[model samples]
Structures are given as structure tokens and as C-alpha cells.
Target: MFEIERRLYDEGHRFVACIDEVGRGCLFGDVVACAIILPQRYTIDGVRDSKKLSPSKREKLNGYILHDSIAVGLGRITPAVIDRVNIKEATRLAMKQALDNLTDKDGKRIIPSYVLIDAERIQTDIPQLGVIDGDNIVHGISAASIVAKVFRDSLCISWDKAYSGYDIAGNKGYGTAKHIQALLEIGPAELHRKSFISKIMEGKK
Candidate 1:
């Protein structure tokens, strides 16, 4: 898992940031991105892709990753912006925002010497590499995945309270049967991505 980082280190790059995003396919809520810089030679046991981990495990590792990271930053792009720009472009923008927001324990900004992203490249002047399935094989990207997942899941919980009936808490804004049924009955909440749900809305009519 550290092999990629090791290679970068050998290439004379320190302070490498690994990034990943969550909630891209959701029908509701913002897309969230995370960027994390880990110390050289750092490795956390049991860290892998967030999708493969149980929610409890992810929550536990989220804390550990944050505690051990050199710097951590998060970015969120709203549903409106996502609708205007499309999910792919919104995801890239969120990644850029995450890198821009990177800050140390003392709240000082930290610019990474290099960036490693999961399957997508953002517009950045910093040296970057986008690895296919990076969150599964790269240590730092895996850690960032956990952080982004936990954070976005927490937002879903809060949104469930604010906007009921779609079961946002349970489905996490996915197009589950219950969520689709609720959309047919109560219509979409303000947070729902209109671009994503146009078909469902048409079906309702």
C-alpha cells in the first residue's frame, strides 16, 4: 500500500497529498472531497477502500487517520452547483477546493509537493497522478476515502432530519426503491439533484 508513496519519496517528493471524493452518485446532498497528507513511511493497518469497510470500522479509522495525518482538508460542492456544472466537473472542482483548504494541526496551510488522486484528475499546478482504483491500493488515498465517507454520511444523517420521506439517512441519497417511491409521492426536496432525477420526475407525471 505504501509502494506508491515510497516511489514518490525516492523521486525526492515529500508531503504528498492523496485525495478522494464521496457522494458523487447520490441523488441528494453535496459532493464531498478530502485531501490528506501523511508523514513519510506512515501506514495504518486495516486501511483500504471505504466501500469495503463496515460503517463502524470506517468511523473508527476516520478518527485515527485524522489524528495521524500531517494535514487534512475537506471540500463540499452544493447540489445547485453540481446541477449547473455536471457531477464530473463538480467532483473535480471539489478536489481542487480540498487541496486549497489543506491545513495543519496549527491551522496553517500546507501545500503538497505532489498529489495522488483516485481515478480523477483536477486542475492544479501541483504535480499530480491519477491512479485507477487508487483508493483500494494506495495507502494515503484509502485513508482519504474513509475520511470523506464518514464525513458525508454524517451529513446525510443531518439532512434526513431537515428533509424527511426520502430516507436520506438510510439510503444515503442513493436511488433505492424506497427513495424512489418517496420521490414519487412527496417530490424532491430542495437538495435533490434535479439533473439526476429528471427521469424520475417525468415518470411521476
Candidate 2:
């Protein structure tokens, strides 16, 4: 909630909420999104992009957000859906799912008075602004980023045990050069986003 008032002015809206997603690049995990609205006076010390925080810090914020937020909702799009709709659309859908789950003080669903996002704009009825680095710039976006990232990353790490060959724990399923090489060596495991990786190699034909 700190440093977020500027969003009210610069975005030309008095009340702004933020939305963000994580795990787009992971080969073995669900994509997660979080939509968060915080009280104007709310403050969480050391809050930043989830990528910048340690696992413990992110976990702590996860609890803090659950306890302290004005409104918070999480949504996840599964790997099958990601493969079917592709990553970008699935990410937006997940964001909308998170948004749909949120409510204002009156116990009724309300569009964010204004919304800020880290990347592409979603064609929703709500008034929204897209900021390239929004997660770091907007506190609510940053908080959502933190929550979504921690949640998704934890799932990836847990999945590493279930699907061992791709080194999911180290790469988090991104199609790194090594990951691709491994895929070629062993062929895709059930965990790989076969469509995305397969596109690069044309189903390895």
C-alpha cells in the first residue's frame, strides 16, 4: 500500500488495484495469478518483486497478505489448459479468474476502481493500465506478484520429485538450453509443455 498513491494520480484514477501472474515459463507447473487490493494505509516492510525476495520472505508475505489485505484472490490455470490455450491467453484468463474472485468492502463483486498490470492489457470491462515494470512500481501489483510467484514456484519444486529427469528444481521448467537438450535426449516427459517446446523442433521431426 505504500508508494501506491502515485498510481492513483499517474494512472488518472483515484483507486487502483494491481494484478500479476507467475509460472508462465515453467514446464511442469500451473500458471498462477493473484489480484490484490490493499488499504490505503497498509504497509508491508521489505515487500518487493517476488523474484527479489527469499523463499522465506515470500512465504511470510503469503501469510501477511492472507491476514492483512482488503481483498485478495488467487487463480491458477493448469498445465493442460496452458497447452490447449497457450501461455499468453491462459495467463490472462487466470488473471481474470483472480479478478472475478475479488470483492470490495460491501460483500459485492466490484471492478477495480482502476487496475494496474505488469504486462499486456486484458480486454476486460474494468478500467485498467499496463505498466511494463508494474510489479516493482505498484505495491499492490508487487504483492500479487510475490504471492503468485511463491505459490507457483513452490509447486514446481514439489513437482521436481514427481518428474525427476528434467531437473525441474533447478530450471523450474523453463526451456533452457540444457532443458531442451535433455528433452531431446529423453524425449518429452509428461511434464513438458510439449506444444511450446515441440514448436521449436516441429515435434522433433
Q: Taking the candidates one at a time, how many backbone clashes does each contain?
A: 0, 0
Off by over 4 Å in 1: none
Q: Please give, for residues 132-153, the per-residue lDDT of candidate 2 as tens digits.
A: 7877777888898987887777
Q: Which stretches of candidate 2 lie over 4 Å from their true place?
A: 1-15, 103-111, 176-178, 199-205
In terms of lDDT, the poorest run of 10 residues in model 1 is 1-10
The TM-score obtained by model 1 is 0.99
Q: Which ten residues in a row have the lowest lDDT in candidate 2?
A: 1-10
Give the per-residue Cα lDDT of candidate 1 at 6. Answer: 97
What TM-score against the true fold does each predicted structure earn?
0.99, 0.80
For candidate 2, the per-residue lDDT at 106 reads 58
Winner by lDDT: 1
Give the RMSD in angstroms, all C-alphas superposed, for model 2.
Answer: 3.4
